[model samples]
Target: MRIVVLAGGIGGARFLRGLKRAVPDADITVIGNTGDDIHLFGLKVCPDLDTVMYTLGGGIDEEQGWGRADETFHLKEELAAYGVGPDWFGLGDRDFATHIVRTQMLGAGFPLSAVTEALCDRWQPGVRLIPMTDDRVETHVAVTLPDSGSAAGSGERKAVHFQEYWVRLRASVPAEAVVPVGAEQAKPAPGVLEAIAEADVILFPPSNPVVSVGTILAVPGVREAIADAGVPVIGLSPIVGDAPVRGMADKVLAAVGVESTAQAVAEHYGSGLLDGWLVDTVDAGCVERVEAAGIRCRAVPLMMTDTDAAARMAREALTLAEEVRAV
Candidate 1:
């Protein structure tokens, strides 16, 4: 089967690793979340895309879940010594190579999609990794700054790139609004719509809802394509229990007024788009509520502590999809 997965950063990337192992023979296409792309030090850094690439390419820092393994930070130190630093986000020497290459390619009039494809060629992430759009759709969060913050002119809310809101401020500021600045005009990249149209299954990994998957779906054609894809669309819950597995999902979730719970997340997506939902065994009680919402729901161990566990989670999601089809 051909599977298309909507993904975020580390959590999403790790899930894909297991999904790949679980469905070894399936044709997998990963639609990476590029919302975390930020311009820093004259380089474009796509955190989610890089995480997915590194994790699957077997060059990821296993613990951090992002950047290159066995990385050094001499370049970062030099930049610091030069008094040019946003030292909050750790960009190691080896990892800096990716940002440098991506920035160089982007400056040469290549869209992000093409640059991503070129980078993937070397990583060979074992899947067709496609950007949702070649068009720039940098996700930004509006938040209260520590001092006087100038507004982005998008609206009254002061805006910062997604990464700055996430990595630098650590989501401590109140987010008034989240916007994918250019998604409204974005066109899906080559093979993106086609892959969705031809996909037999689409999986939503445990990613941040409002910013990660939400940002990708915010691209005009992407969400509509999946809703009309005429295939099973399954989702794995990022909100296991009442908290996020990683990242500052709770803060963002609250910004949107959605309770950070499995039930609340499923309801947020709603039956309008999702066809199947999977939760952890601890949340088995919520199965009925999800099913009552007209989407199929099942309970299984949802923690992805290791590859074996993640693969099992993937298998369970696929199994639930089959069950949903049967029903």
Candidate 2:
């Protein structure tokens, strides 16, 4: 089977690992979220792409689910000692080399897609990984900053990079708005449309909807390509039991005015784009509600507690795809 997955960071990476295990011979193409990409220390950093590559390449830190395994931070420490700021975001020494090479190649006029392919050559992430867009697209969050001198209910509104809100602030404050800067003008990467056009099954993994999968869809022509592909487009809910299984997805979901519920997320994606939706067993009651919206809904175990559990989820997704195809 030809599979195309719209992936974010950790959740997406882990799910890809399971999908590979579930269907070893399937051809998988990963369209990684580049909205999370940022430039730090004058080096370009593609966090989501690197996460997918590292995890699949067997170099990911298993415990944290991101970054390099056996990673050290001597470079970070040195920068800190020199009073170089933004200490909140941790980039290990081993991980720094990747950014260096990517930035160098980019400076040499290589597009991100080519640079990513070159990087993957060393890691060999099993799947063909492509960025959502070659142009820059950074997810930014509009938040209310606390003002001690201001009135109790009022504060200054500021827009910060998604990483700052996610990593530094830990999504402590409510996100008033989430914007994918540059996405409006960004074109899909070279192979993104081709992969979707050729896909037998398309998947939306349990990644953050607003910033990850949603951001990829924000790129021009990408979402339309998938909707018109005439294949099964299935999604597993990241929100389980009215809360995210991992990460602060609820915070961003609220920004988009979507409720933090399995049914709500399925509805957010809508029946037009999604052929099937999977929610955890705890949310079985909402299957009818989702189906009522013209989406085929199935309640199943959605947790990726381990690779085995993730593989089961993958099997369920594929089975749902087959069911959609049969109909």
Candidate 3:
């Protein structure tokens, strides 16, 4: 089996780990979201890509779901002591090596896709991981914040980096707009289209629909390529019942005017791109509504409480893909 998955950050990484276990013999290609990649301290940090690589390769901090396990923060502390810091985003000592290597390669004229491939060589993530684009595409969030000068009444609206909004502000403010900066001109990274074209099935994990999967889709040609791939393209809903399974997905969903509901998320993806959609058993009531939207819908337990749970979700997604292919 040849499978292609579009993934981002923690949720995507965990789901991919399960997917790998579910189909150990399958050929897997992970198209990682690069919109969350940030440049800090003159080093390139691909958070989602690193998360997937580390989780699959057994180096991830399982609890936090990002960064390396047994990680130390001496570098971060030293930087803070030196007064050169954005202390909110924690980049550990072990994780810093990844950024160093990536920055070095990028400085030497290697594209991000190539750099990712090189990094994956060490992790051996069990899948061919490609970034969505080699181009620099950063997700930006537009928010209204209290004016720095006038703190009494209303605030000013401004755009901030996704990391700033997520790591610093914690998405407390409503996101007026979610923009994947440079996605309009960004081409699919090397091997991305080929992987999509050859995929037996494609999956969208229960990652953030707005900043994660949504950012990848914002890239030119990627969405169209998936639609034309002729394989069953299915997705597991990040939203369950009335809220997200993890993260502040509801905040970003509202920005895009999509209600925080399983059925609504299915509609947001639309039948044009997605052939099958999976919602948790708690959202069984949405099955008919999702089906009415021309999507093959199923109610299953979508929580990734552990590897076993995630594997079950992967199996369910694959089964639905097979059903779609048959049709």
Tell me each candidate's TM-score: 0.95, 0.99, 0.98
Name the lDDT of candidate 3.
0.94
lDDT (CA) per prediction: 0.88, 0.96, 0.94
Candidates' RMSD to native: 3.2, 0.8, 1.1
lDDT of 3 at 91: 99
lDDT of 1 by residue, 1-327 (tens): 999999988888989999999999899999887777877798988888999999999999998888889999999899999999788889999998999999999889898888998999999999999988887788888886654564444333478888888888888777777888998998888888999999989999999999989988988889999999988889988988888878878888887889998888988988888999999998999999989998899999999999999999999989987887777
Order the candidate numbers by TM-score, best to worst. 2, 3, 1
Off by over 4 Å in 2: 148-150
lDDT of 2 by residue, 58-164 (tens): 99999998999999999999999999978989899999999999999999999999999999999999999999999999999999988888887788899999999
Candidate 3 stretches greater than 4 Å from native? 148-153
Q: Which consecutive 10 residues in model 3 have the weakest lDDT in total?
A: 145-154
**Superposition error at 121 for model 1 (Å):** 1.5
- Stretches of candidate 1 off by over 4 Å are 146-157
